[model samples]
Target chain A: MDIIVPIKQVPETSNVKMDPETGTMIRDGVGTVVNPLDLYAIETALRLKEAHGGIVTALTMGPSPAVKALREAIAMGCDEAVFISDRSFGGADSWATSYTIAQAIKQAGRYDLIICGERATDGDTGQVGPGIAAWLDLPLATYVASVTTLPGADAPVGLSVERLVEEGYQILELPLPALLTVVKEIGSPRLPTLRGKKRAKVTEIPLFNAQNLELDPAFIGLKGSPTKVVKVATPKVMRSGTVVRAHDEAEIALAVDRLLAFLDERGLLPRGDRP
Target chain B: MSFVWTLAEQHGGRLKDVSFELLSRGRALADKLDTKLASVVIGDGVSPEQLEALIRRGADEVYAIMDPRLAHFVCETYSNILSHLVKTYQPTIILAAATSMGRTVMPHVAVRVHTGLTADCTELDIEPGTGNLLQTRPAIGGNIMATIKTPQHRPQMATVRPKSSRPLPEDATRVGKVIEVPLIESLIDERVRVTGYRTDTADFVNLEEADVVIAGGRGMKKAEHFGMLHDIAGVFGGVVGASRDAIDRGWLGYSHQIGLSGKTISPRLILTAGISGSIQFLAGIKTSETIVSINTDPDAGLHKVADFGIVGDLFEVLPELQRRLHEHAAAPPAATTATADDERPDERQREERV
Candidate 1:
């Protein structure tokens, strides 16, 4: 079972700080890391390759810089790597992103399963996974908590998937040639191996662009997106909080009592003792 | 008639709530677009009864697929089934509740079908000019609203967060059509298993359905301290609520947490004590009809948002109020003064159990 794991390098959400003045995220000095959720997808593919006998191909659609994420996937145990980077692909929404990745998946051409994170941290819109499924016209399962393959097909891979169902989960079984958006509940991701690390440093990733995909230019970026962000801004402060200081412990208790009375008047206190 | 495609989500040998919710939302979208609503159900043991439910909910046609291979949800097989349906029908839009399963599976379908998808959307609007969906949702921790569209993609896809779309008023009398799609062997090529199933059952009411919500913040201190909040909820026949900090600290379950990353509560009344009312959280439950707050800090944001504010320690006020309310029946207060904290307690609070 050859599995393709698509990884995306996103801005470190932890380092993401809003510029109070501009009200936009300041990504100038913040570093980038592979989307945290994608880790589960990569790890799941590696586990599948280990259990069965197949190679894991790691793919990414970003600038040359995204090679880092691919190498990281290699260091974690993928067999091959591909990079689909070009200026035209920048600023693409889920649609273009899915098209680009889907074309690349077709380029890879012979995979039993495609694994991805449930969603991306930057967009938080989890659309690309299903978009890829839509583009590839393949079966898709999302938020898979667990996976176990079934036996007896030439490209044999039967998955018993524990899908996230809000309150709990729903178990599903699907055959080969499927796309799965994995969840952390699947399994713990493996640590990078020394041998794997050695291979990652020297591997040269294959790069593809719009021409390689033969995709229409108008449909590959902001232009291709059905949804356009007419505007993006931070939420304004609706109300500022008030601060009250107690002069002393005695004042603190008294202040509390007075406030309770105020709450009582407003029904903040459900108890009706003070007439 | 324009085609309407609904992703059939089956769980434990039945269709999930979101599936019906999707059908409901799909019905509205279909009516707006002047299309017929169609549903697809995929599972190994899907029953005709389940198909009837989908029709009752609003599906004009039900597509059914039964295969032992599909008894379990393998991404590859189901995605294949849905893609086939979409290709066959060519619907204009696809919507799924932003539940974990919807979030995960929709992306795969979107990718394969070469479409666009919006995630966790709170609202869906159809563009009058293009007939494209104007999918609106909160972004960046609910700090901003984003409206997305998929211009060229047929069956523009989106996943709605649960509770954002209310279940349409159920009317068994409402009628619709049911069409069952033929089944094929699911394409499954992966290694995974289902060891056991355990559901998270809260001792208290699930906050989602509670009429009254009482959330505790860092002020409450420990996991066990949630007992106080729980106790308070019991007094009002409500459910306990928590802040993100409480849930991340494992002081409360994610199910009970109310914030951007957790559940949102839009009850008739929300009584908050010791909560700071961060913007992210405010965005989550700001839709409540009335808000009453108790905080030691006079300048806490919670007070600003509260319809009525009290600046003091909750520990003293809450206990005393509970005591007084236990004394006797408090006369009905004016509708404007819903809580009526000043009124004397009534025998109702003190009523003993048999």
Candidate 2:
């Protein structure tokens, strides 16, 4: 099995906050890190490779800095890394992003399985994996929690997976050359080892640009993306907070009374016997 | 007349509540555009009764595509059908509930129809001059809100967040046209088959659909601290949710996580503890009717949007809230119906136990 994991570098979200009074964004600093869930994807690929004996490749699409994320993936046990970075790839939505990545994959060669995080934190759009599968005309499963090759697999033809759904989880089987967007239930990602880190430092990641990949210029970036963000502003904060104060045990009880009154005013709690 | 189409989703022969909500919103938008509000119902064994119910719920016309092949939502099949419908009808606007099915199918249809789709929109409006659909949604992990428009594409499409709008009251006297379309078996492409479904009943928290959600963040400190949230949520007949921090810390599972990276939820009431309100996490709970925050930090950004804020330790506050809830629960049930049960009163229990 040749496993490929797609990772992304996203602006760290912890430092992003809303300035309460002004209702504006307060970005302490825009620090980038590997999209947290993609770590799980890389780990899943590494574990699959460790069990089934194959090369695990970490692939990312972004600017040059994204190579660092791929290197981090290599540090986490990926055999090789590829960066699909180009000026033409900037401002691509899920549609074009998937197309560009799928083209990059075609250039990278064959793989038995492709893994991605269920969604990217920055975009929060879980469409890229399925979009890539759609673009590639491959079987796809989203929100996969567990994956296992069919028993007695002679160069395994298919894999079974437990996929999350609205009502519950569903068991699904898809043939090889399949794509899976995984949730955290897959497993906890393993940390990088000293040897792996040393290997990562020395490895030079190959880059694939639109020109190199021979992608149609029309389908590569902002021009190719169907949807456009016309406007962006702070979301209106409509509610006003009424802070409750309590210092001691007596004050705490009074705070509870005030809370109950508030709930009653909201018709949340049943109106009990009271004056 | 041009039409505003809402995809009415059904599961196990019952229409999802969000369908009605969509129809209601679609009807309003249709009226604004001087067009008809039509609902597209695609499923196995869809009944005339269901179609009529859709009319009562605000659809002026219901297009019924009954096919066993579509019984289970195969994204390809549904998207194909929808894209074909769009091509034929050329409806100006198409809307669906931002549920699992909508999220999966809409993009495929958009790509096929060569149109644009804004996903998980919290607000939708039409531009007066251009007549383009203005889709406003939280983006960049909810740090900023973006208004998107498909000015060049016909049949402007969007998936509205479920529970963001209220469904109109049913009017039995309402009459509508029902057009039945024959299902083309050859069009369905189902590469994946659902073999079995495993419902996590014991500890499953459908955070998105929950009425009351008690969530915890890194301030809880450890996995065991979630016990307090669980106990409090249980008392309120709600579910427990977690911030991405809690899940990242391995204190909770992803299923319990509410955030940009986890799941988007719009519960009735959400009380978050120890959460400092990262924009990503706040996106998930933005639609909650009542947001109450309890954290030791007074400047915790959560207090900004929170309807009620208690600047206190979770250990101290949770116990106090729990005690008050217990006292409230001990009081007699409300005169109308059981107030202690989960919101919407589990229909199964009503049939089995009531």
Candidate 3:
């Protein structure tokens, strides 16, 4: 089984800023990072391959710098890396984003399983993993906190997962060739090995774009995308913090007393157990 | 009218409350667009009786996919079928409740059809000129609300959280057209097979849907001390929640964690104990209609956001409040009826990323 993991190169969210005049994300000096969540995804694939003995191929779609993201996946233990980037692919939304990735996955041939982050931090959409699974017709489980292998690959890889459910945790198991979007419980994820880092430095990543992937122009970019962002602006901030201006301990004592009574009257205090 | 397609969400072959809420939302969008409402039903278990019920609920046309294979929510299968239906029908808008199933299926379907999908939307409106969805959702925590639009796309899609939108009273006998979609074996794969499924066994409050939430923070100091919040929540028929500090300190599980790194909840009444109310914690429950805070510090940060503030030890206040609540058994219940519990996942906080 060949496991393919997809990583995205996103601007470090901390560096994101809006050009107040133009209403766009100011992307200057915003260094790119291998989506931190995808690192867990890459590690999950590598671990699965380690035990199951399958080849792991990491794929990405972005600018030339994106090759580094895939290489990082390689350094983390993936056997191969592929990058898909072109001018035509700019400004694509999640839908078009998944299309680009899916078409690339198809071009790369077969795989038994695909892994990706639960959601990209920059977008926070959490849609792409399931989206790719849909385009590729695979099962998906999201917000997975932990993953434990079950017996039997002939069936779906037995996957024991702990999901953050309605105010609690729900554990479920499913078979392999499935798509999984994980949260923090996949085991701190294996760190990048020195040997693995050395191999990644020398590895050359193959690039594929819309043309090389042989996808129709209409299905490759903004024109093919169903949704487009009309505008982006720095939201007006509201709710200024309040200032307490009393000077002496007497004044402070009086304020505290008043505040306590107010809370009690509102029954803000904890309640007794129900029958 | 620009169209909004609402799923009449059903669980275990039964319709969910969010389905009705979506219908009401869809109805408003339909009226705004000067078009009719389109509702879809999927699953073989939906009987003709159920079909009749959906029409009465306000759908102008209902798309039904009744197949044994489509019974369970296999993500790829649902996406394939829904994407096919949407592409063929071509509604200008689409919506689903942000239930476990909706979140999973909507994103995948949106991608398959090559459209953008917004998640956990709090508000929706129709753009007058283009009839696109003006979908507003919380961003970077609830400190900001971003109203986004997929102006260039058809069938603008999003999933709103349940209870986030109130249900339009269901018209039990209301009626619409029902279109049955043929099944294609090619659309599904058994790449995933289910083994064991364990039901959530903890008997704690469900913070997301609780109208009255009493949350404990790290100041409570231990796992057992969380019981104080639980006692209060029980009296009010509410759920117990925890601040990220409590979870990080191991006083609570990740499931009970609430903040930008946990679940976001806006309850009617929120009573916090020993919490400092960091921006992240406030991000989750700032929408509460009324908030009461208790802390040892006379000037904790929570005092500002909370509608009411108390400067005292929670250990003393909590037990007294619990005793008082029980003493007031003759009093009326604080919140409305319990919210439907059909949702699956807890939440995704902006700060909780790997």
Q: Which candidate is the best by DockQ?
A: 2
Q: Of the candidates numbered 1 and 2, which has the greater TM-score value?
A: 2
Q: Flag regions of model 2 displaced more than 4 Å.
A: A14-29, A151-153, A236-239, A270-275, B45-47, B218-236, B245-252, B274-280, B313-320, B326-354
DockQ for the candidates, in order: 0.24, 0.46, 0.28
Rank the candidate models, highest TM-score first. 2, 3, 1
Tens-digit lDDT track of model 3 for A1-275: 57898888767644366544433344568888787778778877877777778789999887667787877788788999889999788666677778789889888887877888766655656777887877776667877777777777363356777665443445656666667887654655677789999999999888897668877677666566666555453343333423232334454445444543554455443332222
Candidate 3 lDDT by residue in tens digits, B211-316: 5677889789898987777776766666788887787676765667776656667666777888997766776776666777878776676877766666667776
Per-residue lDDT of candidate 2, residues A131-157 (tens digit):
777777777777888988864546777
Which residue pairs clash in candidate 2? Answer: none
Maximum-TM-score candidate: 2
lDDT of 1 at A83: 91
Task: Please write out the lDDT profile of model 1 over residues B224-341, one tens digit for every residue.
Answer: 7666667666666667887777766777655566765455556646777778877657766765656667777877878887765666676765565454444422544445544332
Second chain alone, TM-score for each candidate = 0.77, 0.89, 0.84
Candidate 1 structure lDDT: 0.69
**Positional deviation of B198 in candidate 2, in angstroms?**
0.3
